[model samples]
Target: MAAFRYFSKKLLSSTLKTDIRAPVSNNYVVCVRLLSYTPMPYDGNPDPGPIFIKKEVQTLLTTLTRVDLAKVYRKRKLGGRQLEQPVYKFMTDEQLQEALDEAKRKVDEILQIPPVVAVRKPRDKVVSRDPALQGLDSSNYIFTDISYGVPDSERIILVRDTEGTLRDADWATRDRINQMYFPVARRQVTPPKMFEDDKLDDLLKRGEYNFILDRACLQFEPNDEFYQKVCSVTYQHINENNKFEDIRSTRHFGSFAFFIAWHKMIDNLLLDLIESEHIDEANALVELYAQLHGEKFRGNSIEEYIGKFSTKKAALELALQAYKNAAKQKHALEEGIKRAHGLN
Candidate 1:
């Protein structure tokens, strides 16, 4: 029985190989099965145990006929994913060489064409003339034989060249006439000569005179000196009383202080931006407000910054509100003091 089973298995394997090699015209059915085997332990009774056997009962996973195989090969030749093979196998060597030759011909044609040249026009010649004399020559040109005394009657003078023909005034002739009549204004005071070593001591003494303060000895009533002293004392007292007021309330001093405060606020805003991980915005803020500060950061415009971090924006707004509130409180205190003293 064992010899008969081995002969049957050899016959089945030969049949499968023959079917695989057969042409598509011959229809053949292929049967496949999966089996598993296990070894049973012997009980030492001088007899072998019964063999344990198991079989997979599943149907065939796929059934590809010869026609299906041909179809898959054709599809793969046209760049389909059904089969794994070199793409160039579908094309002949002569066809591939012809395509390369055609590409080379096109490239050679492009290389043979000459490059386009740019044509530039010649620049206009700039006539050099004194800038001050340009407007005067066009407006005021005294024609020969024209008298300015005849104001009532209309005098039409025929302007002509030296050849006795009517023509526009030549620039050379006009410039000559302008030079003689409208002479360039001369400097009234000549520059002082350099001081010599011996005269330098006197010059230094004269310059030191500017530092001297003349104090009046007499304090007469209704005199300019006494009135000046009184005005100075009154201004000093006013300043002392309003010392608690916001410095931004003064004219030039206020403007300068506000500018400095604005710069400090911008710098503080930079710190907020840095803390929010907005390095680009912080750098841009420093650059845009560089003029407010002494001149440190200088680069691209603020428009280049693209960040919209709301945290930094809110921080700056809060800081500005605080500054405004502080100023308002100082002003209120000053006003209250003035009202108490009957000076408001």
Candidate 2:
């Protein structure tokens, strides 16, 4: 069955013009990513957020992403006005070059991923208690500072419970009051139904990873529990589906790669890199693995690193063989054409 599936994949690839890796059948049970090197998904844990922030690891992740400037500056849905007129500017050679440089710098900052910290625990500190104010209301009174220029992090929020205990507002109440006062452009006070477990699962099954990620980034802070949970589950789903390319070149890819690397499950990711002909990036991933684990590699090649993989050994070997076979076939075809034209 395995041999048959591989043959069928090759035949299908020959027939398809634009899409090579997309399966011949959407319902095909087999994952097409080189026989599932590292079958199980890594739980986004041991919170690599801190380790990822290290200068060397950040550089490696950025290199793996293979940034595309066009995609980097692509306008995204901030969810306010549907239409806006494009501003036109006329400038000389130096002015236009400076403007382009400035734009790239700004986009680089925007693409800098939020740290994937562990979810923040709630704080329920009692600010004050008033016996005289007790029994004044059945529900809590929520107050928010709505002054302009007040950053959300520093904004004061207070909740007065029915017992007259004034405390820091819980996350839910805080979000509600923040929305009431200075609402984010598209986020809801109450989260959308799609974020619910069942709905989120269905979306993941449908491969709506980018949508989940984009909405999660917009709806919650990077450190929020719900935000972390959503991203965690989505990353797991992408891993299970062998769909790393789905998040590649976006801001999320760095975090995604870091998540897998942190868990020491880089086989699938490494295979994906090799299959895509990203040999240098694959080596960079190995370098990231060494840094994360504090292990020293004697050699720089992927061959040296594969000896360390405990799972998916046979499958990863086959994947490497297949990549080499493909590269040879491509080179031979190019040389044959050259020889036919008497140029080689």
Best by lDDT: 2
User: Candidate 1 lDDT, tens digit per residue, 139-159?
Assistant: 433354345653211233223
- Record all residue pairs in model 2 with backbone atoms less than 3 Å apart, i.e. clashing: none
Off by over 4 Å in 2: 1-47, 73-81, 85-107, 130-133, 145-150, 322-344
lDDT of 1: 0.31
Ten-residue region with minimum lDDT total, candidate 2 = 34-43
TM-score of 2: 0.73
lDDT of each: 0.31, 0.76
Total backbone collisions, model 1? 0
RMSD list, candidates in order = 51.6, 7.9
TM-scores for all candidates? 0.15, 0.73
- State residue 93's C-alpha deviation in candidate 1, in Å: 99
lDDT of 2: 0.76
Q: List the residue pairs that clash in candidate 1.
A: none
